[model samples]
Target: MAYQLRGGGGVAPDLNPLPPEGGEQAPPPAAEVDRISSLPEKARLRILSFLPLKAAVKLGMVSNRWSHLVNTPQWPCDSILAIHIRPATQGPCGCLVPTHIRSDQIMPLLANELGRRGRGPGHRLLRFFLKVDDAQTRPADFYSLLDYAADCDVEDFYVDAGLGPPEVSFNFQRASHRLLRLVLFGVGVNQAHRRPMSQERSINTLEVITIENTSLGDLELKWVLLLCPRLRTLVLRNCRVLTCVDVTAASERLVRLTVAECPQVDKISVSAALGLHSFRYIGDLLRSVALPPTCFGDLRICFTKATLVDPIQYHNWLDALPNLSNLVNLTICSNALKIMSALRNRENFQTQVAKLSNLQNLRELRLVLYRMNTLMLSHTYGFLRMCRCSRLRNLFLELPKARTDSFVDAVNGLAEEPAMDGFESLVKVKINNFQWQCIEIELVHFLFRKARSLQKLILVAPKGTNPERDQSGNAIFPDLNLLCLEKAPANVEVQGAQLVLWL
Candidate 1:
């Protein structure tokens, strides 16, 4: 049978074959017809709906008929448009070569696509994302896209300017009411543009707002919260210019607030946020934090490198511990415990530990360590003793790579210490970046003696470490005799890289 290329680059048996022996060609057999191309238009659209916009666009290269079908007014893809402007590549001579999609062309291209979709009830855009790597991207271009998105009634919008020069300033007063989520990176929020909106005209539909690496201030953030009466989550990160985040007027619907790496932010005040359940801060200790007496169920505090050297900062962090009595889950760094141990006054150290014991509701605790030293085991034991161990169910400890000499010293130093009380209610414990060293073995033995209720213990090897063999094909497993597996409780199960003990 002869074949011919079909509209979608598929082969089909020829229906009209050349006559043989001068006889009229038999009527084309009904069973040898193309089936997919003959499918109903709605069915074809349903097939296209399952594909992404890029895949659907590739169909236009198949054939003219398929191209027309893909570009029809009823294009099946959800109304999502994303354009990422790639950075220039280095040429052989060390010169920079621009990418195919120039930054300047983005505005016109977005306008054309949005224009083709038209505007109105059924034509609303579900989401639009734009990221420009070029530092020369014009501020007008960003504002134009924002205006177009508002005109098109886009629901979710994300714009990342790559922390370029001359940050793009956003005016939320004109935001679309249909906007549900907005994420801006390296974009500024102009305080002058934040005018009070009428009660009926506010963006009550906005639920989540995240701004990072910008110059957002306390008043501006408060203004944003006031403008969005129904906002639920707000995250501000790397905003160096932010001096304070006062959410005292935050809406009752606000549930989570995160402020990370904002070095200049010295205070966070939350008073009447009834729905707030989680709060996270990552940076130097704040001068003051006025949290509600209750309602927060989860809290996380991670100190930056500067906190380790600044005694006053870590002391401020220790001072804030007693206020978090309502937290059900808490995540902190080992540096806090190390700092607590530095206090020369025994009375002050005990007072700090007594304050930490107020976390009676803490069920899950995560400790991130920056580095390991001989004193770490003692600091860890002191921290665990301060927490309500009978109520703590999950414990996660992330260890850092350490020198062999340091590990040896730690093992020897802790070998003579008395065994601590066991965790009665702890069910699971995970240790990350576990290197099979003397100190690690000693720590495992300490946990075996303690954590009597531990049902599962997981030790994850450091990233890039070989499980079976070293790079030279030598076996990487340590001497199994050193593990002392007999110390593990009968009810406990140990799991790790290629090593699982049922004991």
Candidate 2:
């Protein structure tokens, strides 16, 4: 959305009236001057609409011709209608609104604006946005304002009624008449709205809906899905309302669903009817998720905790991973890497392999851990040896502070078995939370030696303030202190936080 101004060639010469005494000494004819005003009213209004509301209003005050077009009901400009009213800080226009600008002052302003533009004959509203920051604002005024917006036939509505107690719920059925997309922040939906969703209502036009910081239970959510058949994308953030998300109704269009930071949800069940192509959840590890026996394009799940002592929990996770083998990109984060470390002896190597072998179709793997050490490295080696990530191109590992010697030894151990064919397909590798140490050079050296298809390697060298750079300004990493350092592979490249290099 870029806004640029193109000059109208040059301002038309202003025509001044000639004195009565002058016969032929007349200024330019009025027809030759003020070309913009001479344009049709609709054209002028369209031009004014391109300017911001503040600028358009200011221009109306200055130009009499424009004022008629702007103030009159015949104005053809489809201006973006948005209202921002807050008693504190600033008004919707970001103007310095006084602290005393109470609901009385703001409500009437909103009501009058909506009533005039929205209630006018042949009014067509393309979009509508309202944000109220004052918590003390009257509920009656707010609801009334929404009623006016509905009258305007708004297609997209975004509202953020200020934070309040759980008892304060705003009915959504009022605006569901023509809404295509609805986003609500810090507002709850009324119970009356729930029944309408279950019954056939005018909410079929809704294609996208997002709710955040609101309390809505599983039943209300099920109704939302059942009500809006055309819904394609649904997002619920930090909304702890449902213990389970069971979408067995098989919504054909609901393809993308994301539920994040919802601590209350423990189980998620989806049917083939939803045709979900992408699903993501970020919560505790103990929670269970059920997906259809079909492949999804992307599946990203984050576990809050992965304990080592719980073999039952590990077994549960093991059972879940195979069902999601159709995932193209997989991200797993937990102290569960600790479980890998705990199982790192010769006796448990095959067992560790059996657990992760379900990841057959994975192309990108992101492993986040609480710490990085020899034990974690051995577990990583076990994972790479056992899991079939043959298509894996990008590998991201988040490591904590650990000994450099152990880190290098782990890389060496993984690279020793080239027949494992784990890093053979690896192209890009990024290791975060890394400290620049002498042993890190050997780690990079071994990776560059084994991963023949490697193209780019990024390492976060936190301690090194100065790293050598090539003529192209790419960082010369693995800051080897040795006089004779191993030569990097020809096809590989190294980059630090500052530069990019191709060898």
Candidate 3:
């Protein structure tokens, strides 16, 4: 979820207005300009807090009193790093925040400021954000801030710096102990700088860290592993530039780790499963990846391509997780079926998906087959025969391009197996992005007959190129408690109950 702006709906906070000081100052408009200084104290603080860290401090010119408040320990501080822009045909209306602090200014400010105010409840600030606005951030500025944060025992450092090639490349050993959260977005560091980061943290002091599109070498990551002993949450996205990650700490306190869009992470050996319970790995090539025998509990993996070199490699990787038999929720997606048709690997590969039948604690399963030959879904019934999950109840499948006959055969095969049952207990089934093929309708009919325990069925309408090309229709669902159809009429009670319709 995107963080809501302080004012909601990403609306910017209001700022104080000022009259021009130069001789070129133009005449004022008829309406009065309400300056921030005129606002009440609490309101004024809120307004300043809403301002990006850079702009907030530049407002020292608002008044000397305001300058003191800007540096007060009660307020929040962030790096003025990010920049966003929007344009119009007429012109551009942009919001630019520039910071002017350098190493010299920040050092004294910390030594003097913390000396007077001190830490504790009085120092209990909400969050510390690192801005990356180029307006006034110099390379030296961050080094000083890094050192200052180390000395001050700062925690919760949030960084969004588009730093110069090597703006900040130091480590935090002792001083970084109190740090809890580290959020890095588009923040790059000098990987060549193998210089040891003297800063090493405790076994579990690090609570959570998020990184996106940032390039950090394995050495640096391993450095963090040694320092951040008590890592609870780690999220890495689009960091495919990294090929090696030392997850040696997976055996202790780490609870959740999510990695996505990292194409380079082919081998994931969880040597030390730690306190890990939730693990999600989604990337380009999942076939070659490895998972340790320790990884267990809630796990999710997705693949839209069949480029998996060895299909069984993934199953072997899954087997490595100790508690695989007890997975609560499992989701598998493959969009490569279309490409697989030409290769003839579909028949052999079907066994790979069925191998997931061993997940005993699996209660909910969502399978998405994108633009792949949906007919291959028939192979899933064999999986049903192998599955021993008695608690399975909810099933959701998305076959946007599945051939109609294949869909029908899949359901029919499942129903034919008497011992392979979920009929009376299965409550929900959803099929999205339906193709208008005849087999698609047949599949729906087959589901109505096979799923006696089904309470709800949803058929999502296929998209139309233009609004004019859309079709208006409703689908029949006999013996079902609820049916949801798209691009149809209202909730007309056709038979037993009114099926929900969306246009």
Best by lDDT, which number? 1
| Pick by lDDT: 2 or 3, better one | 2
Residue 461 displacement (Å), model 2: 7.0
Writing each residue's lDDT as its tens digit, candidate 1 over 134-179 gives: 7776777667767777776777788888644365777786677688
How far off is residue 324 in model 3, in Å? 2.1
How high is the lDDT of residue 181 in model 1? 87
TM-score of each: 0.70, 0.64, 0.58
- Compared with the true structure, all predictions reach lDDT values of 0.67, 0.61, 0.53
TM-score of decoy 3? 0.58
lDDT of 3 by residue, 423-498 (tens): 4456776665565444445455555676676777655554442111112344333323443433444544221222
Every model: Cα RMSD to truth: 13.1, 13.4, 15.3
Full-model lDDT, candidate 1: 0.67
Candidate 1: stretches off by over 4 Å: 1-76, 87-100, 163-165, 193-201, 306-326, 339-355, 358-361, 401-405, 415-422, 453-455, 463-503
**How many backbone clashes does every candidate have?**
0, 0, 28
Question: Cα lDDT of model 2 overall?
Answer: 0.61
Two-way lDDT contest, 1 vs 2, winner: 1
Local error of candidate 2 at residue 276 (angstroms): 2.1
Candidate 2: segments with Cα more than 4 A from true spot: 1-79, 89-104, 119-130, 161-170, 176-178, 193-202, 272-274, 286-288, 306-311, 321-326, 336-361, 398-425, 430-447, 458-503
